[model samples]
Target: MPRRIVIVGHGMVGARFVEEVRRHDPAGERASLTVFGAESHPAYNRVLLSTVVAGGLTAASIGLHDPDWATRRRVTLRTGVAVTAIDRPARRVLLADGTSEPYDELVLATGSRAWVPPTDGLLAEDGALADGVATFRDLDDCARILELGRPGGRVAVLGGGLLGLEAARGLVGRGVRVTVLHPHPHLMERQLDPGASGVLAAALGKLGVDVRLNVMAKRWTPELGLECDDGTTLSVDAVVVSAGVRPETDLADDAGIAVDRGILVDDRMGTSDDRVHAIGDCARHPGTVSGLVQPGFEQAEVLAGLLTGADPAARYLGTPLVTRLKARDIDLAAVGDPLVEPGAEWADASVEVLRFEDPFRGRYAKIVLRHDRLVGAIMLGVPDAAASVIQLFDSGAPVPSDRLALLLGRALPGEATSAGGPVGSPALLPSGALICRCNTVSKGALLTAWRAGATDVAALSKVTRAGTGCGSCQSAVSGICDWLAAAEPAELGEGAA
Candidate 1:
């Protein structure tokens, strides 16, 4: 009697959608779920692949789903089974194994695939990855890089974006000499300004990473290293390509779903057909950007609410993106439009740009405010300021009058200050403040889990799904746990008295 929901592509977003739906329909009174994943392994956090390559995390550590998770929820999860086609007339999906399954509604979370350039020797004649070259995208790529990248070996990473830089840093941690080739002159040009990029480059240089800006890989081979556009060759044992990713939209396109660069969806994550819905990297809604897990997770929550009738009026306006780089020895977080050109529109208008740069110390902080509200910020080498800025941005709180003090990690006028300055504390954060952007977990949710006897970080993670994605919020989650532990004894002492 329950509506059957068939989901394609069991990546992070898809797995999350399953969890959301099950949470709403715990008794299976509304919907029965079936998920088809093309990958052989269970869903894992793609953002933590760099940490796995760096030997900090194992393949199993970053997994999102537990054993028998689907079984306990009465969901059918089929891994290693690709959905070949969608038969709209019959409302059934064809599988690679020549089987078919009928559905009342369908969801696509195929996510995206790494896009490697057409450089010579990067791909074989059959379109497979050639020897000594890999794209840093998924768990398989991490395994390949780990096997190829030996200590004291040489590695060439093509691309200077976030993933590329992370890959380069991870290889460096493995004692491999790394050279990053980027077409853009600055690192993370999309998220960082040129000034911040320079500071980051200096930090990377100190960490023993060779950064080659404004360069492109013209060709590559196993015998010879990457050949640059400028007629230069560098010898390397392995080549890791972090060029970028393209959404996997072939299934949606072939099935008559509206497709642009990604599958187009509405506010409720519904596709052209009423019976079909899409979310995650494959879903392109207004104001939604790909490659960030937060938007996809938000879309999943919205769609689940709509599907389960838990909140029929629920709508996804869009996610406020917070970008964090998880590379070792580097701390950087960028939110909104931090990169604004001088003399450009909004430069002299309501926008106020405050910047502090210490190039020698490899530190930079930039905050963009509009009408005295935090809109965008870039913080590097300033963890305390980064936390406060992120809180202000997430909460849409008013900026204090002492803007410079906030940028310099000093306490505001009414705030309590420590000897080292006022570091943002979990206790100080608003309950609604986001603790996990990827999963949209809030501080209140974490506290609720803590009150339910999930005292440690690991237990809290399982209960509230905090500190799971990208693992950037682990420090924040730990801070909350520490605060709770310290507060519990005080409450117990007061009760005894």
Candidate 2:
């Protein structure tokens, strides 16, 4: 008899876990899967919700599964069903619909919920969102914002973080007058330094967003708009809160699972109970950080390997995260620890920092190297530099001696030069080099899919699962396809020549 696996949640990470499991257990001789999702819709890309808000993509465009996907995979998928309680002794999970399902193994992928801070009049007496107030976290929130965010209307966004900035930019594109209220002194303080934040703020200003920093919301009402802690108020048509998110751990806590800020898991993604595992944003491994989709996808792969018995010794160390701001007209990418504001006494002696800032042009680049290895980087308004820095960081390559040239996107020594300039060829990238961070897809995997007759970008994406996560690597994937098309004939004629 095959092991019966029950998975809770159907978000991006959960869906990826399912795909990975099916990939390894195609015959279904080892395990049978069942999934329970609270949301009514199938799994979709949450990373592209900002794009949907910007009118670049519809909700249907981000879907991950077809209607018959579960059926064809021999998996039982129950949408709009919440797993309320777990009866460990009975080895069953109780659903909100008064049903139960037995499981030999259970996986938790409940993900996280957007956090709303304590502000007056933000919620009703029944704990429902007040009129004209919404949190930008999921597809439902996107739809609500679209309904309320009218052109020529005023919208107040609370928070200056990545999501908040994305929402603000999308609303601005829709012709809404946007005012971003942030409690922090600078935008994206975690990913960007003060100097880069200043440049980003200037760029936002050019996008027609009014930024009010170092202020918190005192209260909010549909009639009176948002009142700040500084005793000031601004009228607006709607309020969208992108404050942050908290991992959904209530079910795990109630079920006696070890949990900190999120569900605690070991290197194998196993919880306190060996049969119960956790992944995605809800799982808090010692080495892994939450909120990014890359880490969650990595965790899913590790867990899938163990569960499918394909690689029982598989262990998840952690993910080296790369952060990108997906706002329109704003190009920015940050990798590893952007050692911003290091102590002056130890800064110069410990790490070499290379920085180039042009506030007038809204461009800033900073690269932090430790012991001659690329450790961290931040690039804005420099796509070429960003691509090179990310590749170097990903591959653990040595930094070139011409630091200024590298910072300016010039050709590194020993690299082939082209008429277009020093942009490295896609063919030079190692097969293992990651091209899609969101899905953890590598260049070699893409090439393998292409060699298998998946020639076009869309077909390659469907086959290798590349360029599907945040859609940030779509251009890179297209470039690789173009490169492959040009190189194929040359390779075939090598023996003849």
Candidate 3:
């Protein structure tokens, strides 16, 4: 008999694992699988939950279409079933319901939870785990914040990271007075530089968000509001903590899995115990636990190979370059180290520095380059340039003599060398061209599945395993389904949506 697999979490990483496992054994001949999710609702896009409150999507619309995906894959999905403990010695999982399930091979995809700092008086009259003070990490958290929607309401968002800013933006759009407090001076410190962060700070200020920098939240006063270390207090209601995430390795720790910051694993995503594996934000392979979606998907791919009895030799190097998808503005991106070299001297014009700052128009574009290498770039009103920049960085192609021309379609004299491409050809598509990056499914694969009679996005997901991770790619995948249905001359149903 095939080995029984029990996956702990049904979030993005776990969901991708299910997709990969099923895709590897579509005929359900290789393995028996089960997924236990802590959340009652089916998996939705956690990344875009802020967008849901910002009027970008609805509650039902945010959820994944494959509610019975596990069932279809012959993998049992137990939503709201919390796994309290794992008995690795016996290869069994202890559930909160006092039921224990045995597995020959176990995968702990238990994703991370939001790190909530200890605060003062912010909690309800009840205690620390109060109803009022919350963290926006899941759909239920989004719902709670949405429930607190009142015009001109004072709301405080702690952390000032991407999630915090997104949450503040959503709250502000809803007429809530939003203030973002961060201990650090810059936002998205990990992804952006000081100069870019300065630009972002100014942009956020224009949005009526009071951006507090270099001031840590000392404590919380239930009545007066947040107490800052700088001896100042902001009178606000409700504090949403977005202060990063710690890996969910408690289960792994209890199960005697080697862990350092996160559950330790190899390139194959296998734990020290060969029969066990881990993925997503939970697993720290080679001193890294990638919290980003791309790395997590890559990890899923690695784990998928291992479970299917493949060579599993494909090593997962860390994601060196990545694109940032801003919610409502310019594409502020970083590929490799964009920081300036110490004591390096050069004329400003010699190195291309395109600066388009129109404060009145709320637009800013500054691209820093040293000898046409595409070192660093920042844009306030240019998202189209983002794709090109990412492509240039990804391919490491030598920049055309006139770098600005590539950005703005202006042909400097003698700078028209190999620009543009075959409009209708597949060569234009990135080898890693994602039909849905959220689920790590490729366009070519999705198209092949579509031609194979997987007509709708929902059916396409059940077949091709797309749009199952983050629902951000759902819009793109849905568009593809529409194209296939229209181009194929088929009578499509509501599933096309």
Candidate 4:
């Protein structure tokens, strides 16, 4: 008999676990899976919610599964069902509907929730969102913000992190005047240096966003807008909070599971109870920065292999930090340890740092190297440089001895870059070179999937998930598809150049 597996939470990581399980146990000979979701709708891509707010995509367009997906895969999927408690002794989960489901193995994927700052009037007396206030977390929040945002109205975005910045950009794109409130010296302090942050703020300012740094919201007045700690009040139509998120771990703690910051898991994603496993934002693996989808997706794959007995040796160590701000007219990617102190910030003479800042043109490029290998980078408004730098970073290949050439998206003599890339042509990249940092998709994977009938960008994304994560690699994936089509014009059955 197949091992019975019950999964809680139907967010991105949870849905991915289901797919990974089916991939390993294709014939269902290893595991019988049942998934429960608190939300009424099926899984959708939450990363693209900002795009939806910008009118670039409809809310209906980001569905991860079709209506018959669960039925076709022979998996029991219960939506709009909340698991209120985990009955560990009985090895069953109690549902809010007063029902219970026994499980031989349990997986928790309850992702994080949007954190609303404790500003006055942001929350109602009952602790729900107050009127004229919204959050940028889920689909419902997206709709609420859209309703409150008018073409000429003003909106205040709290926080200046990736999601917060994305929300500000989206709202501005909708013709709403937007102000970004960040309680830090610079934006994206985790991923960018002060210089890069200044350049980014300038770029956003040019795009009509008003950015205020080191500012805190004192309160939100529904009738008068937001009051800041600076003793100034801005009249806005709505306040969208993207302060941050806390992992959803109430159920795990209630069930006597070990949790610190999140449900604690080992390298194998097993919690204190060997029968219970955890992944996604709700679970904390040692040395991983949570609240990102990439880590969770990788964890799901690793856990799936172990549970399905497909790859018994699979273990998730950690995901290298990669941050991308997906906003209009903004192209930025911070990879690896970009937080490493720059010139004066550190006394390490062994580190080699290179920087090029063109604030006028809204471009900044910084590369950190040690032992002749690329370690980290910050690239904004330089897509070409980003592609080359990321490839070198992922492959641990030594960068060009001429740091100037590498920073400007140029190659040394006798390079393939004449075809318009620092690394020459996309075809010349090492097969192991990573193309999509968010999805961890490699060039070789794209080639294989393309040969298997995924000829265009959309098809390749569907087959290999190249352009789905942060969407920063969409252009790169499209370029690879074009190159493949041009390289083998006859082999592409359809959608060929």
Question: What is each predicted model's overall lDDT from 0 to 1?
Answer: 0.85, 0.86, 0.69, 0.86
Task: Give RMSD (Å) of candidate 4 vs. truth.
Answer: 3.3
The predicted structure with the larger lDDT, 3 or 4, is 4
> Tens digits of per-residue lDDT for model 4 on 94-161?
99999999999999999999998888999999999999999888888899999998899999999999
TM-score, candidate 1, is 0.95
Error of 3 at 392 (Å): 2.0
Order the numbered candidates by TM-score, best leading.
2, 1, 4, 3
**Total residue pair clashes for candidate 4:** 2
Runs in model 1 with CA error above 4 Å? 411-425, 488-497
Tell me the tens digit of each residue's lDDT in model 2 across 254-306.
99989899999999999998889999999999886888888888899999999
- Residue 489, candidate 4: alpha-carbon lDDT: 49
In order of lDDT, best first, we have 4, 2, 1, 3
lDDT tens digits, residue span 362-465, model 1: 89999998888888999999877887787777778898889898898663433322111122444455567677777777777877787779999899988988
The global Cα lDDT (0 to 1) of model 3 is: 0.69
